[model samples]
Target: MREALCQMIERLVREEPGNRFPGEGGPYFTEPLIGFAAADDPLFTQYQTVIGPFHLTPTELAQHETPPWQPATVICWALPISEETRRSNRTETIYPSRAWALTRQHGEAFNSALRRQVVQFLVDAGYQAFAPQLHPAWREYPDSPVGIASSWSERHAAYAAGLGTFSLNDALITPRGIAHRLGSVVTDLAIEPSARPWRDHRSNCLWYREGSCGACIGRCPVGALSKEGHDKAICRGYVYGAVPEAVGAEYGVTSTGCGLCQTKVPCEGRIPAGKVSPLAVKPPEGESPSP
Candidate 1:
């Protein structure tokens, strides 16, 4: 099933017309990384507090089926943005580039279609599948203490699926890096969960592992990111607020994004080597070494 699903994702990125940019004729997502986890994984239950109380467990989601379901598994995938798009945004200091804005807005539409397609494929194969993001129950509550959080966090699911870990910027740092998006589906098939290589959620991050490399903090144009972590309200205001007001009118899109922290950094496309020693380079004044 994993191999089949991998092939399906490859085909979608390579052959799907909808995944292509309007005039560039290139794919929005370069390639995708897929992982699996048991439906009853305890981490899902833990996510209720980690994300929000509204988060649903696999069993709770399965109950929505016409006939109650049993044990299941979750298939999660990460879609890395194309280098061209990342490069475009990396060159900007204040607002998102046109490519970045389009990817964040239209690219999500493609992601939704991909989710629907995957669910349909699983159902057609005699298995009951559900995409929590696509479910009616899915909801997003802004301005939470934990930044802008949602009921079902695709990045958290991807982490449990062994796709990657969280970075200081709060983006999922997969093998392909933080400039990407994630999606997942829950199904009745009990597939084996992927191996989680790290002991802690932030183990893969250089800032957490070695207390060095706080490039993301410098990349934040609005000063939303500091040694403590990211300031969600400020970041959101810049991306969803100032960005659209400044560039949305010209781009013909309402939704805007800024991924400066994710690019022009060592961890943009892949994990960096061992951490830099604190003695070699000290963090900016007033900023701590901790991520």
Candidate 2:
């Protein structure tokens, strides 16, 4: 099942001509990494606290269906932005490079298509499956326990599936790195959960380990990031506000991206080469992690 899932993703990102960015450009994303998890994983339930109580668990999301599919597995995958796209974005100081903007606009569209195809593939195989983000009840919450959050977080879903861990920049640092997009599906077909090698949730992040390498912090144009961490309000204000005004027409994409922090960093394409900082085990006992 894992091999089949891997092939499905690779074929789409590689052979699908539509996978390319708009205009005469390189592919939006490259080699994909897939992972699986039992829908009943306890980590999903714990996200109610970490992300917000409003975040939906797999069973909760599955219940939204007609007869309610009995979800047994959660399939997750990471689509790394193609090197061509990342290279372009890495050169920019503020606004995302044109290629990066197009990737965010078109690349995400490809992700949505991928989700639909995965669901359709499972259904054709006589198994019930669906993408949570596509569900009608799926929504973003502005008044949740977390500042601004959504009903189901794909990053958290990937984490539970053992695809990656959280980073100081708030992006999931998968083995392939932090510069990628994630998608997942819930199905009745069961598969063995992927192995999670790290000891802590933020173990893959260099900053979290030894309080060193705040590379992403320097990349932020709005000072949204700091040694303390990311400021959702500051980051969102720029992404949803300034981006539309400053980059709207210039890039031919609106409110799509500014992933400066995700590029030109140690963890951009792979786990940073270094020793772990014992301090990054987890937030001190009383402090909760920001979504």
Question: What lDDT would each prediction earn against the true structure?
Answer: 0.80, 0.83
The list of candidate 2 runs beyond 4 A from truth reads: 277-290
Stretch of 10 with least lDDT, candidate 1: 282-291
RMSD of each: 5.6, 2.9
lDDT top scorer: 2
Q: For residues 64-157, write the lDDT of model 2, one tens digit per residue.
A: 8899867999999899998888888888888888888788887888899999999998888889999988988799987665567899889988
Every model's TM-score:
0.91, 0.93
lDDT score, candidate 1, position 67: 79
RMSD of 1: 5.6
Query: What's the number of clashes in each of the models?
Result: 0, 1
Against the true structure, candidate 1 reaches a TM-score of 0.91
lDDT of 1 at 20: 83
The local lDDT score (0 to 100) that residue 70 gets in candidate 2 is: 75
